[model samples]
Target: MTQQDAQTKPLTVDAVMARSGVQFGTSGARGEVVAMTDQVCHAYTTGFLQHLAGLGEFSPGMRVAVAGDLRPSTPRIMAACAQAVRDLGGEPVFCGFVPTPALALYAFGQGIPSLMVTGSHIPADRNGIKFYRPKGEVLKEDEAGMRGQVIATDPALFDDAGMLKAEAPLPEVTEVARSYIQRYVDHFGPQALRGLTIGVYQHSAVGRDVLVEVVEALGGKAVALGRATQFIPVDTEAIRPEDVELAKGWAAEFGFDAIISTDGDSDRPLLADHTGEWLRGDILGVLCARALRAHAVVTPVSSNTVLERSGAFAETDRTRIGSPFVIAAMNAHLAKGEQPVVGYEANGGFLLGTKLGSLEPLPTRDAVLPVLTVIVASRPGKIRDLIEELPPRVTYSDRIQNFATEKSEAIFAKLLEGDKDAQIVRLNEHFGAIAGAVTQLDLTDGIRMTTEQGVIIHLRRSGNAPELRCYSESDTVEQAKAINEQALAIVRDKLA
Candidate 1:
């Protein structure tokens, strides 16, 4: 086709996804950086705007906030997205290299749509674009809407490799960073963390410096450690072995009250206690909810059962594993006029669904809130003391990388072939040696089976990549790890 014809012809989001090998994952559009060319990124941004426009959340000449992580590809992707905003007759407000939540907060406060260029905890070679409506994250329906869009673009704007011929320079950084830091300082008070010594792990996370600022502003002596120049894919759910040792060393060396860090975009958090023991995300969620005095709590089914067993909240709900699902459940309670509703994930990303005294509800995964809350709530005693107060439930998770999704599906199909009794029999046959007889099964998001001995084992395929994840909960940490190891071994052997 001629250039003019190509410029006029519209492209469907699905078609672009197929052609470029970039598709929406659990949270956003993700793929290898090489697959996410300027043309592809532009098309996605345009499609997102088109979908939001239909919902009356976007319009021409309106401002759309944009931000990025510290990945090398992020700036280039952000430029493409910003150009698309201009092409769509909307103004692009570059929020600079800020955390995902900071960009969302700024856009929400201004009542404007926004986009973030990040891959979250993924590797640097891969990246993603997370869309946000004026209020919060786009839901499943919004994803459908974006996927169904047909976006028109000018072919002349891009080169043969789909890169922009002349990339538009990103605008000057807005005051988003300052405002985001102030959000915490103003809410928690300057003396909230008084008499505390905290270590902030600044390992190339986009919000590394921001984390330090928050800790110091809250009146804690902040020590920055292991600042990396390159991107480090730190998965909070499966804490890296090196990170675990580093935290232990830092705790012993610095005598820190607590050590805190975040994933690449700073949405998910990593918090280690004085003993260098990192708290699980679900446990952190429970502590944060208690600290905030939340009445209603929502989280993924993959999280520990301690929340329900602790009797801390008046109501609790579980959903499929993902922020969108947790946010949806939180919104459902809010629609019913539930007060002080909150949500979190198994990755330690806390979401506040209801407004507190001076802090507005963010309703997105946040690292700062939980980092501060858990630390403050642990005061008057060490973090270990807070753990002693909780129930005896412990949860552990691990995954098999490069595992085929088809194989995982086959396993699930075989296991879930018959009724509950038959399914239980199948599960027990596989895990009974380590976990005892399967007593109950919960398939909210994955296969969560409870044994006669009260051990819980859950298995699911990763939404973003070809992998099988296993989770286990038991009365002791050793038992949880053993159950997880046994489950992974069984799955691996079956695949073999």
Candidate 2:
């Protein structure tokens, strides 16, 4: 192509998105980084701003905060985003590398729009950008509105390969990070965790440094563990067996009162009790909501059913497995005039629908809020005691990675095709000998079946990747884990 022609060729959002192979998902526009060329990133950012302008949330000269995870590609993505903001006549306030929620909190405090460039629990090779409106997270409607909007990309800021110039410096780190550090400190009060020894698994999360700061700021002795320079994608929904064991080992070795960590973005938390046992995110969600005395709770259908069985909340709403869905349900409760309404995903990212802690309600999932709430609520007691307060139901989850979405749907169709007898036959054919007969079926976000033997099995396509995820629940932990393993084993066999 001629240089002038190339320069004049307008970079449209649709063409860039189509060529880059990146698409919007549960949270943001997630895809492999190789496909997320600077040109594509810049176009998407402009398109996002264009949508915001229509909503009156954005205008020229307004400052938009930006943050990212520890991934190597994040800097360039942030640079592309910053340049886009500049090109569109808005200023990009680079908040350095901070947790997704931390940056969001700062932006919310400033009452301005913001963007976070991180994949969040996805692999390092992949990344995404989550946009925030002035008040809170972008909803499904916002995403839908942004599509099909064509935006021109500037060629000057990019290299010949359509990548941001590496030498171009990011904005000076802002005080927003420090302000976020003090956010928890001021709310929870100093020395809230005094006399407790906490272990932090510093596994390359963007919030690693700030997590330690929060603990220490609260007068809790913070010990850093598993500090890795390499980015580690910690999936809070599907906890790795190694993380489970490491939580225990670290707690026991250091005689920790609790061990805390988060996924790459620090929006989803991982909490281990003194016994070094990792608590499920749903369980943590339950405790956090009850501690805040929330009147209404919204969660995904795939989460642990124990929260309902415990009668912890006055009302419980279940949505599909996505932040957008959860946020939508919370808004519905607001329409009903419910106060202190809250929501959480199975990943343990807590969302406040109403203002709390002297701050306006941040309508996004937050790891620090839940971490602080659980810690303060379970004060002067063991973390496991909080679990004892809840009903005794166990949950387990696993996934068949690289599994095709079509195959998962076909298998489900075959299972749910026939009447009761035929369905049982098909279930057995796939899951071998499950606990008992299928007594109930729920098709909320995916296929969930309740067995007469008090077992629950759920299967759904991963919204963020090419995988089929399965969730199992039972009265006992061992039974729940067994159900998950047995079900995934069947899937693995079929895929093989």
Candidate 3:
């Protein structure tokens, strides 16, 4: 081999992913922790920086912000990313273990790129990295650009096992938590949450302590509960049964006005009413958007249709299931001169696309905004009161884990075969028993069927894991839950 060839190895992100099995998911690049070696993460971060550099969003000697969740493997992976930043002639500013949006806000304010080390509510054994350009989160196009780049690296930097031979320590923490807290406090005023009693279920979320500080700064009585030593994977989208019971018991014991929590990375939120019933993400989105007086709203197809039924916003749009798609739609609305535009997911991650008064647009999934907005909007009433004011539509969702991606694709292909009429017939034949007579089908993100009785049932494969997700909506919460359960059962039977 030539001397130059030995020193300069050309590697693409696709090649690394093929060999390491750590590929991009719905949001970011994710895989099991075991496969995310130092070399793999370094390559991923380098590719991200390379992509940004190409877009003129990054340059050598520029600063890059980095942060991570509280997962065990986060520190090591973050170290690897920091080393990559240094190796590429950029400075790494460690933001400590803060929420994803906090890091994004700081980086965007500083006009630099950022990377977050988090699996985002997934199991602790698995982890992921979310990349951000200077302006906002990377869209689908940026992801493709990262994958196609041929990164140059020296093989001697990593051992045969892909571990860095000599990894550098992460820099000291640069506190972004204060700014994040102040963002809400300043917007809502110091006494915005005065006279309210809130129970914050702090189950190992990266932003747990920050949540307490924010609540207190807003003059609310914040009761911190359920602080765990070990990492807890809390999926705000799929609230665990134990968490539900815990919220109920806590509410009863404490007589709180509301109970709020966040997922592992603290991007998606979990807000339970005074009675201990957790609100659905789409429901939370609707309430938050209404509270913010948003002129335009964009959400995923799997979200509840109440955004339209509530008649709150001047315009509402639905996109495919993912933040990237939602962000893209929100951007379009902004380009069209829509004021105070916002977007959210079915998982309660609120995204503000346009500046509202003093607050700037973050344009990423945020946990605290929706919870805080909903609580403040409730005022003297409880969280349930704000929920009751919305349209009488309920949505529920659950997933079947360990379901292969190929199997999910096959099911979608079979259901979406032929023309729209033929697709409707297939959907009715499969789900008629549970959903009455299917009248319409929406193939936006997945297969969403609307029955004649105004019931909605949506089936979409999980983009972050090998899970098949089912969502249902109806007039009542009971009916929505029942439909979700029955749909999952039918999908299971089909898989069998």
Instruction: Write candidate 3's Cα lDDT for 361-449 as tens digits.
Output: 99999999999999888877778888778878888888998888889998888788899989888888889999699998888887889
Candidate 1: what lDDT?
Answer: 0.90
Instruction: Write candidate 1's Cα lDDT for 101-140 as tens digits.
Output: 9999999999999999999887888899999999999999
lDDT (tens digit, per residue) of candidate 2 on 1-496: 1224336666456656666778888898888888887877887899899999998889999999988999999998998888889888998899988988788889988989999999999888899999998878888888877876666554665676677665545788886778777777788888899999989988989899888999999999999999998998899888888898998888778899989999998999988889888888998999999999999999999899987898878989999998989999999999999988999999999898997766568788888888778878888888888889888898998888878667887777766787766776666666646778776778888778788887999988887777888899998889998999887887677633
Q: What is the TM-score of each candidate against the true structure?
A: 0.96, 0.93, 0.97
* TM-score (C-alpha, index-matched) for candidate 1: 0.96
Question: Residue 339 CA error for candidate 1 (Å)?
Answer: 1.2
Candidate 2 vs candidate 3: which has greater TM-score? 3
Candidates in order have lDDT scores of 0.90, 0.85, 0.90
Sort all candidates by TM-score, best to worst: 3, 1, 2
Q: Report the C-alpha displacement of residue 99, candidate 2, in angstroms.
A: 0.9
After best superposition, candidate 3 residue 296: deviation in angstroms? 0.5
Candidate 2 has a TM-score of: 0.93
Q: Give candidate 1 misplaced runs (Cα > 4 Å).
A: 1-10
